[model samples]
Target: MSDILFTRTDERLGEFAVRPVRPAEDTALLHGWLTHPKSAFWLMQEATPEQVEREFREIAAAPSRAAFIGLHRGRPAFLVERYDPAEDLAQVHRSEPGDVGMHFLVAPTDTPLHGFTRAVIGTVMELLFADPWVRRVVVEPDVRNRAVHVLNEAVGFRALRTVSLPGKDALLSTCTRAQFAAAAGHAPEGSAAERGANR
Candidate 1:
């Protein structure tokens, strides 16, 4: 598709692709995912379709920010947001130069595959690192989200500290290219500077 910007193939899984999100076309689908019980961590369990659309629309129009749909084997399976942390997490975390903020959520599925979420996150890291200027990937996930905390650690995110945001306490974490290489048990892919590239 014209919007597809990045692609990766997991050794065990199939292909993972990322494309700019089309707010109008994805409203209904995104609404379903945002309201699912498994997505409670996203703080939009009661979101209406209109709310979902509006939120994505705002994200789409924001400068230095973008929303992408992650596709697995050509089917939309997840959501990813890339942004400048200096503005998004400005009040909470002190962002360094070349830092990029990221958020990812896997769509709830009844037919779940083993290690699917991990693979998706890994691929996402690879996708981010693909850009040469991305020196570090930054994330501020809710502190109570233990599952995501574990995943962050698995991907080499070292928690800097817990900080209070507008509505929740968050664990500010970061991962560099060297750190990710160590965690992924592989050498650096390409000239990875960290905010990241496909593995």
Candidate 2:
């Protein structure tokens, strides 16, 4: 079976695609992305390849959670995680029927494109909402990470409050499909927002 799980296009960014993460096949790539200096917020900068693989393997084995590798124009460009909020975030954010917790990390690059990160996040949101059962997307990003906060708001996420997670203080936020569509539509194409980083 082909591994691709979702595909979407950005008017200016060509094609963006996603596939189930293969721990063995993607270890090297994920390790590099997770350890890059830019990925400081990912909290695994010192993680070994084995540690990274083990993490993905755990995600792969979880029925309530799944991880995917995101592609830009068919090349891997980011990482995505989707989980049922009821099972994963109930302690922090009360469970809701259609809530899905999300996290994404863009691969660090020597050449960062203007507006590229925003497009990546926007596409990720689109991918999640395409599932009719998913009513909203939730995130708990480090409160100190201002860059991601700007990017999150740029795409329509409303900050609910800060909460204590296992390792850090996270800003709990959410965005609905209507909110995303409104934000995406109000913009003048791709140039109207700030970029994003990982959780």
Candidate that would win on TM-score: 1
Q: Report the C-alpha lDDT of model 1 over 1-199, residue by residue, as the tens digit.
A: 2667777778888888887788999999999998999998889988889999999888878888888888999999999989998988888778888789999999999999999999989888877777767789999899999999999999999999999887689999999988888999984443222222120
Kindly report which residue pairs in candidate 2 clash with one another: none
Candidate 1, run of 10 with poorest lDDT: 190-199
Off by over 4 Å in 1: 187-199
Quote each prediction's TM-score.
0.92, 0.91
Compared to the true structure, candidate 1 yields what TM-score?
A: 0.92
- Predicted candidate 2, C-alpha RMSD: 5.7
lDDT of 2 by residue, 128-167 (tens): 7766677889999999999999999999999999999877
What do the candidate models score in CA lDDT, each in turn?
0.85, 0.83
Clashes of each: 8, 0
lDDT of 2: 0.83
